[model samples]
Target chain A: MNDVRSINCTQCGAPLELHGGHRTRSLNCAYCGAVMDSHEGYKVVEQFHDTLRPHCPLHIGMQGVLKDVEFTIIGLIQYQTEEGDTWIDLQLYSPTHGYHWLSDEQGHFIFSRRVRDIPKPAHISNFKLKAPVFLGKQRFYLYEQYRAKVQYVEGELTWIAKQGNWLNITEATAPPVCLSYENSVSEEDYYKGHDAHTEKEYYYGEYFFPNDIYQRFSVEKSAQDKPEGIHMAQPYQPGLTAAMGQVGGYFFWVGLLALFVILFMNADEQPRLKYHFNQTELSTPTLIPFKVEDPQKLLEFRISVDRLTNHWVAYEMVVQKEEENVLIVEKEIEFYEGRDSDGYWSEGSREARALFKLPAAGEYSLSVLFDGGSQSTPPPLFVELYEGVVVVRYFLLLMALSLLFYMWKWFHRRSHENRRWEPVTEDEDD
Target chain B: MSTSPYPAYNCAACGGPLTLKFRYTKIITCPHCGAGLFLEDKAVKMRGLESVMADYPSLFSLYENYAYKTQKLTPIGQVRFEYAHGFWDEWWTLMSSGEACWMSVDEGDIAIEQLVTLDKMPFMPDLQVDVEIELLGESLRVTERGSAQCIALKGEIPEVIMIGDNFDYVHLSGAKGRLVTLEVQNGNLFAYEGQWIDPFEVKRL
Candidate 1:
């Protein structure tokens, strides 16, 4: 740039360069500890005996892209408060967009710049913490206020600066956006009762993740630098986890309805196999032959006994598939406990039947035996069987399992939002 | 035959014959080749890209002159300073008394300030913006404070400030057209007091 001046230190004759900015009147020479005047032909204005200083991540003239804008870091200010707190503001510049400030406090960075068009608050006294204010129709809440001091300076600057300049700062935050008010009471003309007080209020904000600054600038210590704390503006993606539950909810119900449909598709009613044996004094049990059909269908048998009094009867049934003897489905059909009290109660039944899901449809023979008391009046025995198939229990179980899975997701997201808003302490709906 | 306050001279950079209409302006740009000169220092420099124009968004041309109240002021050279948001010009105007003042046009807020020489003032280094302080027996609040880089200089100024020089200034505005500017120049304090005016109050000639 034609505006830049290249010269040399008057004393040491070391080559010096003044940044093209028309406002940079003086600068500290890096080669020697001399503060030289840029306008005064590079004359040394002040000399320092010590050359020791702290290290900084950025040097003058470093260029980096932030948030899609390219800027050159032209200056760095190291500020320390009386309470031992320190922060740094890196002055970034673009030929097209002018100057911006990147403030690095501890490990947190706030990128900002001077701006106009900021809406004035209705009243200045209303600027308090948690107070809601509107800027350009966008609402924001006041977050914090403090005072800061500048302890050191380096590189080019647009305005004259001092090593110990201090400012009172107030910030309003709306997440990813913030408003800052910097007030400086100039020591100039103060004693003359002409206290020059200045206030600079502006808004600058953008949310940055932990690795956002590092990756965005391809920083050297980016891998080691970890951003800590929950920024108000950090993006919340609860749907990333909750979305799975929502989809699962839809699929779960659909699967349950499908299972019910499938269970009923194969549902059938089969004829019952019944055989009877009547005898006063039971000797060897007689075998009753019966033909069976489908074996996959659920088999049920219902047996009934007639004319039984105080005596209880027990019976055993065995199914033989032709030459192959199947299972001996033994059951007791006793009618000993009679109904006599206020509520009719029976411990054992007189007739009983057992269901065997036969493996194959073969010629099966059922052997039945009945036993009764010798002294008591025995009942004339008769047996009957009925069969039915239904899947009501299975459908109910499927519905319960699907509902439980989806409920877990909804509850998880609720806890996530609760933890996120815990700091606010109060909210409306969301 | 002329009531003009100053003598005429030739433009230094362009060697164009020049005439002065008011004695207060320190720098004057050549009409022929557009070369601006620092009249008090007699240093003539050409306009760069940064100092492209004297007025922006507003269409006041280089020929515009103004009559502020009973004072006859002529718009001379201008100094351009920029912030992150935008840039404005400090229009240096010479009065009939051969004195210079700065007129600022910001967002239609027009103000003209004359330099103030205060005998005693508070230390400005620690003063913060938005803080209220008593000045001239009136309570005032510091409204804006920052450093501004002088991007370009086209007019004559009373102070010995160079282009690219840094200025730490605090701005304070009060009710009823009251304003104060505190600037740190050469490690010394400088103040300015001014009043706001309407756009039509400054008659164009």
Candidate 2:
């Protein structure tokens, strides 16, 4: 509910216009730069002799359009930091839309409206980059934070805005839109310049592009020369960045899909034959014969050399081509395990396998020729023949390929994001 | 703060007085001659011929200023395409701040749009209209699907303007404020999102 009030400046003796919105406790004289307490019959609370007016294009009663909504400028407040950094805020009010604000700071205009639907963190300081905060269904990321001291004030305002107000302002930008939280760090946060105090908290801000602002309002510039300052939201390549995100997402899912399909296809696998042979069979370094029942597909022979730690067993294996003609193939199996400061580490493998396809599915003979072994303890050797075990090998290769593809896509996206956040966010949120 | 980067110039083709509104605009339709002029690095050339869009005149016309919210906008150029149902026009618009957007007439409705790139679409181009597809945090429906041949083009284009070119596109409708269109052009998929805007709200200047 808005309670209208009227008062005259004590110093300038000019009529001071008061605004609606039940929050005005102080009003500044636009004529003589005199601060007045509107509640106490236009009492001269504070006065400034120096003329330090911020450059503003809109004045009270001037109407402008933003986001296709028509709003009138009703008030203007100037806030300065301890380091002399200052920005001007123009209060915008519409009969149908209530109230919002257009803040011009360092040539960058921020269109802001108080948003109650924002989910704030328990501590306002918890806002930082990579930390996600949600507003409605849209999630916003904290981008920057600042602490400002409100230095001066003027015009009609909703809140009794005074000077020397210590406000902890935290901002998170989602490009085109920025989420800002103004917290009164303490009772001293609202200084009211001299003798007034106003407290407000939650705020939602959006970075209006220069083009959008130019279209929204008739901007009156002091410099009628060249257009210089770039809009805060100007450099963003929305179309390209949006496309990059989409492409990155597509590549990532494609890689994941390929990985899962490969895994599912190899989940069920069975070995054909598993056999054990003792030193008595391999003692005679001669070719010992064996026959396979079926060998249409490629069969792999895994020889497990059951030797001592750090020991190796070397043997020559031969598979007959069904005509009793032996084809010699050499193999060695060794395994070593040891402990160090970094804990136990293992090297080599105790098993070695050879895979090859036979001429046909008919009986194919195979033999093992042991080259080096001690006869004292019968050399224990086990052989396992597997059918269609190449799936696992192919899966490893595909997984690596998919991982590489995703890595490349994400790396490409990272390059774009680096540009998005490239501007050093230092003291930018005035 | 509003200044046209290119000052008032004469249309080379029609020798008519033309003024460019936006800073980044490279093409504009001559108000007097209605000829599309492509501003090049050295000279202005005649762009693709303008093809008629609708039987009745459009409520908005080329080079005319229309108020979209607090900002004043001017329609710069237009591209005409024929779909399965009929023909539609996409008007190139420049905002007061020099930002550009495109407008299309969809089923007797004005759809204000901007080019947006999306990652991918779940369904193919053959997805039926009204099939709900969740994208960009909104539930969008598959709407228009057909090949649109660029039969007529006039005005400024950010890129090269080509007439008679064709592309197959799938349009997805998201609520009243959002429309997603996925178009496949020469094997490259392009996406654009738009909102259905009320023509009554547009103040003709």
The CA lDDT of each predicted structure is 0.61, 0.64
- Give the distance in Å from residue A162's predicted Cα in candidate 2 to where it truly belongs: 2.0
Instruction: Name the best candidate (by TM-score).
Output: 1
Q: Give TM-score values for chain A, per-prediction.
A: 0.54, 0.50
Model 1 docking grade: incorrect
lDDT tens digits, residue span A28-143, model 2: 77777787665566577776556566666556666678766667676887776556677778887653344678987665678887653435462454445657776666676776
* Model 2 stretches astray by more than 4 angstroms: A1-8, A15-25, A48-51, A82-84, A185-200, A220-420, A423-430, B1-205
Worst 10 residues of 1 chain B by lDDT: B54-63
lDDT of 2 at B141: 70
